[model samples]
Target: MNDKMNLYYLKQLLNKKHVMLVYAIVKMSVYICFVLFVFFSLFSIDFRDMQLSQSLIFATEEINNSSSLLPGVSLGYKIYDTCSSTTMGVRVAMALINGNENSALNEQCTKPAQVLAIIGETQSSVSMTIAKTLAEMVKHFGWTWVGALRRDDDYGNSGMAAFTEAAEQLGICLEYSMSYFRTYSQEKVLRIIQQIKSSTSRVIVAFVTHLDFEILLDVFYEHNITGYQWVGTESWISDSTVARLDKHKILQGAIGLAIPNTTVTGLKEFILDINPLKSTGSTIFTEFWEALFKCKYTVQNDSEDTTVCTGKEKLSETDNEYTDMTLMPFFCNVYKGVYAVAHTLHDLLGCNFGTDVSVNSFRCYGEEVYFDKNGDPVAKYEIINLQTVEDHHEFVMVGIYDSSFPAHNRLSVKMASVPVSVCSESCPPGTRKAVQKGKPICCFDCIPCAEGEISNMTDSIKCEQCYQDFWSNPHRNECVKKEIEFLSYDETMGILLTAVSITGTFITIIIAIIFFRYKNTPIVKANNSELSFLLLFSLALCFLCSLTFIGRPSEWSCVLRHTVFGITFVLCISCVLGKTIVVLMAFRATLPGSNVMKWFGPPQQRLSVLAFTFIQVFICVLWLTTSPPFPFKNLNYYKEKIILECQLGSAVGFWAVLGYIGLLALLCFVLAFLARKLPDKFNEAKFITFSMLIFCAVWITFIPAYVSSPGKFTVAVEIFAILASSFGLLSCIFLPKFYIIIMKPEKNTKKQLMSKVPVK
Candidate 1:
């Protein structure tokens, strides 16, 4: 968009009269004084800069509006488009100065256009067309951000001021700027030292004299400050004394300007060609011969301490600082200084710039010749570093900061992490960064994640909340699954319950074996051994069913635990009811005209037990098919863990199963109570009543415990109730018969079994 706009504006300017009428055979004279603005383009090829003809017009208008500035010398402008070409710019410059557009090179010229000053060609190449030619300015050490320092004296102050103006125009930011003279107090010097240490910039640009520069090197050396890339001016940058004083190697990597040295072509032959014999009248030439051979003239040579002088000594064989041209650029500076005076004198007399020129008038150093804004002898400088060469402090030329071009190989710097040394370090993992008041966003405090929260990444902005049924680890770096709680068989309570359950089943099996062995004995037969065996079998199943609840709650275990318990308990109760009915029928048979014994015989007794138990079996099947128990994770009960347990799918189904078992137990308890005082040797109905009472009591207490127990304990309580009730029935109904068979052999007779004892 900007390119298009600029192109359109330039096209408009091309159609204007003042620009189109710039050239012709006709002498179109203008009386007004003009400042020619030779510009590159509406848009520049280098994106960093844009040169506009409109700005020149604005500046001329502003200057003309201020009468106090020019004092009625109205400044108008003849703007020329150089098209970024040095060729066209040269033609325009010659025409403006010679006072006519067509006759630019006519030496016998007339002042016609009255053009006073030229404002542009904005491009460097075009600007130099007016001043003959030019090269690139010094290719500085690639630093765009820096800290500035200078001496407080006039020379250092003026040098730094020029750098400051250029730095602002070039868009470089100064982290800090300070100045101190050699006469400053220790406290003031310390403050400058503190500022240097505090600012994060690694590069420092110091424009100071050798005298003031020594102060900084000493202070920084004493404080042991190193790793700084120093940018120094020529005054102290080349000083050998300062480099030697940097003993701790504080400024070893420093880069700065220094006077250039050169071995000019044909210089050796030029020296060898000179002869003192030809210049015999000159005493200085004879003195140079004495110095070259380390000797004195004939009168002084007679002294034994000195060698004789030979004016005919071969100068080609000699090698020294002078002959080698080690300080050639310094002498070249002197040469340029001479031409500066000559140029000044020529300009004052209106002499053309082409005459009376020396190698000094343009750049004539190194291997090339060039012109720059800072004429030189050119701005010829070497980029030197303070380094340990050959185990001694040496000033070595690393590159050039001079007007000599071809700088692509010379201009290089490591563009490493610029802001690595921030105000504070990065926040570590498991912690969040918190910015403090009046501090930059890069600077912060690291705060650890709070309880139940975590930060998994380094330098996290905030901590995250853990999900439900999860928790944060010790380092607070991540969320993990919470520990699951359940009554696994490995735990103490589960182990104990399992042991009791297996033991009860074992004891019941032993009783059934003894009853089978004593099937012919009266005590066993009179008490209905078949019914006793069936009751013991049901009680063993009751004990085994509790084992289902003592493990990790799963879908199968959950359904098996409750269903098996309900059916086995019901079967046990049905056996007790059947025994209680037989006792009542036996008591009624002894009464007049009673046939109750015939109706409830052995086969009938078995059928009654099945009929009653079948009711419970049906209830269990309905409960399981409709709404069964399944495993669930209860997160609401605890904030830190999950309670992995069985959840009754339908509350109504669970309660109905328990209620039916309770009804059967109550029926047995009622029938046995009435027949407890029968006149028989062994009234089993009284024991049946006691066992039913114990079963009812256990389950009565169990309901509340099952509801109130939490987590794994809830499963434990159910197992406990099952074990307690099973043990009650086993001890109450079978232990006495077991004692008679094993310990009392006489009670096993039919005579003792048939003997009746009246109840009170």
Candidate 2:
């Protein structure tokens, strides 16, 4: 009896199923006759809720209401919810491609549907998966240097992997890759925010759905992290909910790829006119109405907190989500997707509308809908910036990313409308980059170029060295010609020294004239008038040689000055030494048994002077032939100026010349000191001793001053010493003799010379 009842129930159930199957076929055939073209749209309706679904419905209504595209034909669409899952998205895409909503694993579209194109799987991972299954159609939109933020699921991971691979092949750099979950922990969201804040990339390509990004934005708002240039996919790029977030300032100046939005005339009025009573089939609209009015629609199980709707609530006055057109990127994508299918069908069907030839391309609104070789719509994305208009933050049309343009010029961003974020400030000109340790390439220290080097650009890696004849300016930005410096006659010190040298020469000449005029005078004759004349001539030469040290040095002057000065001074000192010996021998000859006077007579005295002077001449000759002083440009003394001076080529040879002169002077000084108390009027021994003392003192001081001095001062010190010593020699030896000869005629007599003789 139970088997008989089961068979009757099964027969009745089968009969009802057959009737329903026939009804479904009859309904599908009737709908297919009216549908001129069909396109499928995949969205994350479960995760993103009503917003994603509403975007497609509103876009379909806009296309259906428009009379411009497919004048007589109607457009139809089928949408599937992926629940923000890549696997679901793939299944939905494959089902649409195979024209079988129930087919889970169909490789080919055996039962091909009339669908022309697939609009989207809003999430990046879902879209990437669909695109990969659809023959890598993502390459149609070229993007480089993008930061990826993906969901921490199979959808996000696989999508990010595909994008990363394709980006690498296209030479695109992934600045950062972060992951988030649908039900993310606060710690994870905070960590993602911190990573975004620390990343140097300004363009963040978010591969998450609307809800995932909303959570991230909430964390970003809490931390006050902003100025991230978000390159959004279709998911949240056009999501009106993100614009309605409490802190929308975080998204200001963000740029993203968007479906070019067109004015769907009366779409706002259509959305505003919607009510739960009028839209009986739209359960999402009823939910939207309740959320908008903060009221309940049903009275069956009403709670104390649930307010009953008056049915008079205005969507314009309420917290509505679909009023603004700036947040309608997804709506435009669906609208274009419908038109893309209509245009493809219109071309494939050979539909003639006022033309003999059928149109292969169709312009829907302002966009030209055409399919590429891969059967995907020609990728045309609008670059939208999240800008503030009045008090409302919304997407502003800033630029376009057209696939038709060249790769470099494809994405045209309005830099003025975009905000920049970087790890470090740009290093200004005149500074070079010093990379910070343990920091990103963008984070670096600005260091000024080193001495003699320059950096003319911002963030230069290394400073360039200036040319040999050039130097860096104060700012180290450029090279400037070095100042040509030399010991010239126009300088103040040079003029003063030149005047002093001329004066000393004049004084020496005057003394020479005085000694010559009084040649026969007893005082003059007593000092040996010939030796005095020769000494005066040598002193005049010494004063004139100092003039060389006052002017610009040259190769000729460098060699001339040192050699002439050395030889002349030696001649003068030799004359003094000759006089000292003459004085010693003259007094000793008066001692009756002194044979020393015979050994050194007037001829021998001349011979001794020549021999002593010849030694200095030999030393100077060796100095000139071996390593003579030459003009040198000294750059190390001062940074800005060159010291044009003579370089003493051989230190030993130069000192040898001075040492020889000193030896002669020291010997003369010692011999003169021994005979300083000679019992004779107008004794020349005291004058020689004093002159040698002054000469030694001047030279001793010159050594330190010369060594310590820099640039032209070194030359000045040597010249001053030469003039002082020469003057000392001329004054000490001849002044007293001139006093007696010119002023005291009686003292100049030979009797006066013998008056000071000591009685033994």
Candidate 3:
């Protein structure tokens, strides 16, 4: 039967192994799958093709050809060629040409043809007409768009009425358009469009100042104004303006344009090349003029009366283009247009998707380009959007003063504006405002701090520091005396009390020993042992209370030092109460049966000492957690260095602890009174009562001393109080008992001492 049972167990164990193996295999498979899923998820991102298109046409005429070429298409699917001048009619032509080219680039040059999006354009009413024309034509391509449409053609001398009529005729929405008749087509048109459509579109229409600004109707291939939409114009395309106007976003589709004293391929190098003393032509036009002059183009002086020959020297008489000039008089922006087209194309056509047509296949190289409300590319253009007609909202009005003179004529051209309030009060002395625009000044000049002042804060309104002979406080807001004056009696008394306590204790110990060695001395035997406990408690209080003198207000010393002192002081008082209880027990032990006498033994005495100490410790911990101290300062002042001080919270909390100690003191007194009737030989009640009275007197005197003392001298007064009370009791009581034990050898009997009656 045993064999059969063992066999059965063996069979069961073998089956269990297979089950365990199967379970392990299943868990491993699950873990492997989960890890694979996570790994794949992290490494793969849905990379859809991106397309960027910017159309800007302004002052230059080159934008006309850009309307048919690919911009970012060669790189991916971006269309960049847009007019950049501020001329109204010309901006229109640039916008149309850029929009058309962008669409073609997206549909033709880009592999896996994608519909073009984003057209840059000017905001002139005429430019809007072209935008409407181009929009209608490209709507079928299913692409997003952006542009700068004019609010009104005020510069066309066409009153607001005329500008609005023309805009309506072109089907341009004014709210989404940037307005202003005068603008740099390349600089403003594209940016305005980007700003307007930035919320939704990443495509743009550039330029609103072209003679053929309304040629946007030709995108239909039939020159028919069917569904085509025109974003804006190039300066060479817009008609002459007739009225007054201000900041506007006319170059909506412009992508990037020429910046004075800057270059496209090597911007950092170009910026470094600009010299303040040279003219604008010296920096950017260097290569263009060199090429032109090499081709024998003559250079003309400013007056046009004089000319320079193709050679490096000046010509006596000729009307030739100043090809040698480093900067193009009005062609620097146009020159950059060629490179812009090349860059945009490169970004769009770099990759070749399968030969399939779909919106998802549209690929743009970098991050999505910026656009205006109408979905035009945010190409380079001048300011086309203005918050107000009269406010100095133009770039020049808000830009900082770059006084790097003649080499850069565009002074007061703002590079950046203060993002937040610049000043809350008058500029600190030494710093002056160069120009003010709203609350923040456009320009500021830093001035050095005066002889006695200091500039501690960033962008300080004025230098501030203490006057001569005055020392700055932690806050640095004001100055105070270098040396503190100890003025009050309270301040002077604590030190005095500590000294007295130390001196008196030493003397008492000596005298007590001298008297106790002589047994014939009746005085030594008469006093009670309870006197010894009184001296011990008093000395403890004196020692602990003296610590307050060393405390100072600071991060390290401020609050903690004061709290420790308080706890120690309370524990000392509790010790005094325990002393009184011992005295009462001695008297009560005279009864035939009294456990109270046994309770007065050394163990109980130690426990009592521990209990008092624990209670004070507990209170200090509570206060530390509940209402911890903090630094104090004034709100109006900004200070670098801070002052620290421990200011106790809620005197009520402190008083509550004091009250408990007071109750203990009162109990001590009552017990002493009850035991006073006992014989003087063993009676300590009289001494206890006297010591309690002395303690009360010292504490009462402390209040007046504390109130009258200077802040720095308050600790001294406290120390004095501790000494007077504790030391006085030592002299009055414990000194007598020591005299019996140490001085009177014949009277010193251990059996007799132990037999003494304990107070109840």
The numbered model that scores best in lDDT is 2
Please give the TM-score that candidate 2 achieves against the real structure. 0.68
Off by over 4 Å in 3: 1-538, 555-564, 592-595, 628-645, 704-708, 738-760
For candidate 2, the 10 contiguous residues with the lowest summed lDDT are 19-28
The 10 consecutive residues of candidate 3 with the worst lDDT sum are 45-54
- Which scores greater on TM-score, model 2 or model 3? 2
Superior by lDDT: candidate 2 or candidate 3: 2
Candidate 1 ranges with C-alpha deviation above 4 Å = 1-428, 434-456, 463-500, 550-556, 584-608, 633-644, 666-681, 708-713, 750-760
Find the number of clashing residue pairs for candidate 3.
213
- Give me the candidate number with maximum TM-score: 2
| C-alpha RMSD in Å of predicted model 1 compared with the true structure | 16.6
Give lDDT tens digits, candidate 1, residues 1-760: 6655544443344324122212110011111111121232232121001112222333344434554433333445554444323444566677776567555434434664444344433223111221111111121333445677876644445566666666555434566789877778999988888998888867777766455655677788777667877777665666655675676777676666666655433433443455568766755445455655777677653578887776667756776423443333433333333323323322423323334433233333334444444543345556667667766677777665433445454343332222222345567777899977875454578999886789988779999989986888888898888888888788888888889999999999988888888888887776566788888899999999988987788899999888888888888888888888888888888899888899999999999988887888898888888888999999888766899989999888889889999998898899988888887877888888898899899999999998998898888888888899999999988898889889998777878877889778
Pull out the clashing pairs in model 2.
none
Clashes of each: 0, 0, 213
All candidates: CA RMSD in angstroms?
A: 16.6, 11.3, 26.1
Candidate structures ordered by lDDT, highest first: 2, 1, 3
Q: Give lDDT: candidate 1, residue 503.
A: 95
How do the residues 347-438 of candidate 2 rate in per-residue lDDT, one tens digit apiece? 53343233332334666556566656555555666656667788887777776766667766765655563344444566777899887897
